[model samples]
Each structure stands twice: as structure tokens, then as C-alpha cells.
Target: MAEDFDLVKIMESGLEGAEYNKAKFPGLVYRIQNPKAAFLIFTSGKVVCTGSKSVENAHKAIITLANTLKDIGFDKIDLDPEVHVQNIVATADLKTNLNLNTIVMALGMENVEYEPEVFPGLVYRIDAPKLVVLIFSSGKLVIAGGKIPEDCEEGLRIISTEFDNLGLLS
Candidate 1:
């Protein structure tokens, strides 16, 4: 059984502690790296915790860490309530190279957008809020936005299933 750790209390205390020593600890508290990256570290006693890199990866890593702790018989210990995500990479690759324009045409451009920059790619804002379909010129496909790790896993599984059904891998 998961311990009932009041996340709110932990967050409030952590913020207070972090704010109290902001001068000595740069990037110790809440610091946004960009629109999609960040770092978070908060220590409460022996639980020295750190999570950085895209929000998605951070959550996954933290959950895995928590499970490991629990498995090691630290069920009574509550991890810090605040979840930190520092990086989120969105990319994908299909067995067959897909044309961005063609895919957009099939999916309709109303819900999708494309951009040009350091990492130029097309972004598909599907109906699902927690899901994003990213297509790149290098034949890399990325699926990001699964709020829960299971959701991400499901998404990948569904992709793989579809690929199998269509013999895309063969």
C-alpha cells in the first residue's frame, strides 16, 4: 500500500526552505529551463531527491524511484510531494519514411501545426490533450503528451500493434 503522504504540506515546506536559502543555492527552487524543460531538487531528511529533464521523463523517473524505494521496504517514507519534470523530447520514426505534408493532408491541417527552428518538425495537436504526434524530416517520429506513464506505454503499444497489423515492420 502506498503511504498517505500529504503532498501539499511537503510542497509548502519545501518552498519555504528553498526560498529561505535562495541566495546560497542557485537553481535550487523552481526554475523553468524553457517552455519544455526544468530541474527540481528537494531534500527532506535522508530522502535526497532530484529530477530533471522534460516534465514527462521526470515524472516517469520519480515514479520508478518511488517504486524502488517501496520495494526496498521504505513504504513508510513519503517522497516529496512536488513532482518535477525537466525535459520532454518528442520524436518518432516509422519503419517507412513518411511525408509530413502527406500525413498532414490525411489528418487535416486544422488540428496540426508545423514550425521551423533549431529542430524543425511538424507538430500534430490531436484531440487528446496528453498526446502529441511529432514528425521530423529525418524519418524520426515522436509521441509525447501521455500524462501518465501507462498512457505513454499504451500509445506505444497501440502504435506497435497497428504497425504489426499492417505488416509495416515486415
Candidate 2:
């Protein structure tokens, strides 16, 4: 989070090559290449970090930003900022081809949406893990909207069990 950040001062400090264009975008886009993450720093002390493959990488990016700000004479930055994992996306392979039509019928209309002409995959919304899993005909699955890695794993397990019960696999 960018608490009361003076973007002008930060830009003048020349600590890092950060992209800031108030007229074009409200947030300062600071990118770190090591862990591969981009931080969107807004004037309202709101920061949104994205593109990190894992939560640890995200935390590293935030910490690095805070330290850089402090080193650049920005004193209001919190050394230990409160971090939260808003979402986690994961992918897996079921190892057997899926029949979208059959799986849709077995999983029920409310939870599954499959239109081959519009999309090649089926969108399966799972409630317990509170995430959406994309099931493809080639046995590929993409799980999204998970707060933690475990949530994604749990979602995969749940869906695998459901598919097994319905005999939808293969």
C-alpha cells in the first residue's frame, strides 16, 4: 500500500525507473523483474500487486518496494506491511479427455456452462472452495479465484472426486 505517497518526490529521487503518468493513469506502475511482479501504487494508499506466480513472490515484491521507498527518504512506509492473498490461479491435468456435454449434464446447469461454439472449455463454478475451474476437452483444468494455494488444490481434489463419481473422466 502506498500511504500518502508523493509520486513527484519519488520520481525526482530517481531510486528506480518507475513509470508514472498521472494524466494517463492514476497509479504508479513499479515493476520488479526478479520475482516477476508489478505493483500498482495509487494515491489513496491502495496497492495492487499482480503477475506473481506464488504468494511468497508477491510478498517479496511488496517488501522490496517498501524498502526501496524507505531508502529513498520516504519515511511513511511500513516495513512490515499487512499482506493478503486476494487470488490464486492454478492449472492441472486430469489425464483423460472429458466430454463437456456429459460433464455439464452431470454437474448440473447452475454450476456448469459449456458452449463449444463460443468457448472450447467448460466453466465449472465450485462453491466450497469459492473458485471457478475451467475444464477442457483435452483433460486440462485451470483453477482460479483461490485465496491460497491450498484452496486451489482442494478445489482440484473436489472436482476430481465429482468427476470420478459421475464417471465423466475418460
Candidate 3:
């Protein structure tokens, strides 16, 4: 949930290392090293936490920031701010080399984008799990745009199933 924040008050309250320069950036940047997350706290109280390796870590970081805000005497801060995972970028390996041209041809032209001249990885967008996977020739895949961590695994499973059906796993 988003609430309004007095950025000036938060700044003057000695929030260690919290930077708020309206001219440079629109929101205040609060960083935590333990969970390895950075938050863009806006005047509208919209907190965008990034750089956390996992969903649990991101939630922990947000709670840490909220507690910090409360300790700074910010009454409007919610101790339990609702966190929404926008995207989860993850990587996986198929353990076998892939021929981009053949895979692209078999995967169909509707959901695949393989512009070798523009980018080396083949961009494959799946509608089921609703995520994008970048397939490389070296069997590495970078799955992005997932709302949850499971989405990445589901995408990989879907890819594996498709490849298996097409006899491309070998």
C-alpha cells in the first residue's frame, strides 16, 4: 500500500545514507546492505525495491526500511508494506548446445525473435507462464519479466517440454 511521505521530514530525521535531491532524482534512495536491496521511496510513498537476489530478501529489505522509517518517527510508514513482485530475472542452463536457427524455426515465428545481427540471444516470449526467456546457443537461458520466482522455473519447464516434443533436447 502507498501512502504520502514527508520527504523533507525523513531527510532531516538523520536516516543514515538516505539521499533525497529533488533536482537530481524524483525520489529518495534508501539502500540496505544486508539483504542487498535499494529502494526508491517516493513522495507518494511508492517504494520500488530492487537488486535483491530473491523474493524473500526483497520483502525483508522492505520491512527493514519501514522499521527504519518508523524509528525515524515517521508515523505514516507502514510496518508491513504490501510488496508486489514486478519482475524476476533468473538464469538457467539446458546443459546442451542449441542451434538457434533450427530451434527458432521449430519454435515458430509468432513468439520467437532471433535477430542474430542485432542480438546474439534468441528472445522467446511464452504466454502460458507469461514470461520472456532469452535462449543462447551455449544452452544458457535468461528468463525475465516473471511476477514470481516459480514463473522462471515454469518457463524453463515449458521450454524443456517443447524441445523434448520436437526432439531437440539431444
In candidate 2, position 68 carries an lDDT of 84
Per-model tally of clashing residue pairs: 14, 0, 0
Q: Which stretches of candidate 3 lie over 4 Å from their true place?
A: 8-14
Residue 86, model 1, lDDT: 26
Name every residue pair that clashes in candidate 2.
none
* Per-residue lDDT over 10-57 for candidate 3, one digit per residue giving the tens place of the 0 to 100 score: 889988888999999999988889889998889887889999999999
Q: Between candidates 1 and 3, name the one with more favorable TM-score.
A: 3
* TM-scores for all predictions: 0.44, 0.87, 0.86
Q: Which of the predicted structures, 1 or 3, would earn the higher lDDT when compared with the native? A: 3
Model 3: worst 10 consecutive residues (lDDT sum): 1-10
> Top model by lDDT, which number?
3
Per-residue accuracy of model 1 over 1-170 as CA lDDT, tens digit each: 13443334444543333332445652234322223222333343222233344455555555554553455455565464455332233444565665566555655677678655544777765454456666665556777766555555555565556445654444
**What C-alpha lDDT values do all the predictions have?**
0.49, 0.88, 0.90
lDDT per residue for candidate 2 within 1-170, as digits (tens), equals 54677877777888575899999998888888888899888877778889998899999988988888889997888888999888899999999988888887877899888999999999999998899999998999999999989999999999999998898765
State the weakest 10-residue window (summed lDDT) of model 2. 1-10
Worst 10 residues of 1 by lDDT: 30-39
Q: Name the candidate, 1 or 2, with the larger TM-score value.
A: 2
Ranking by TM-score: 2, 3, 1
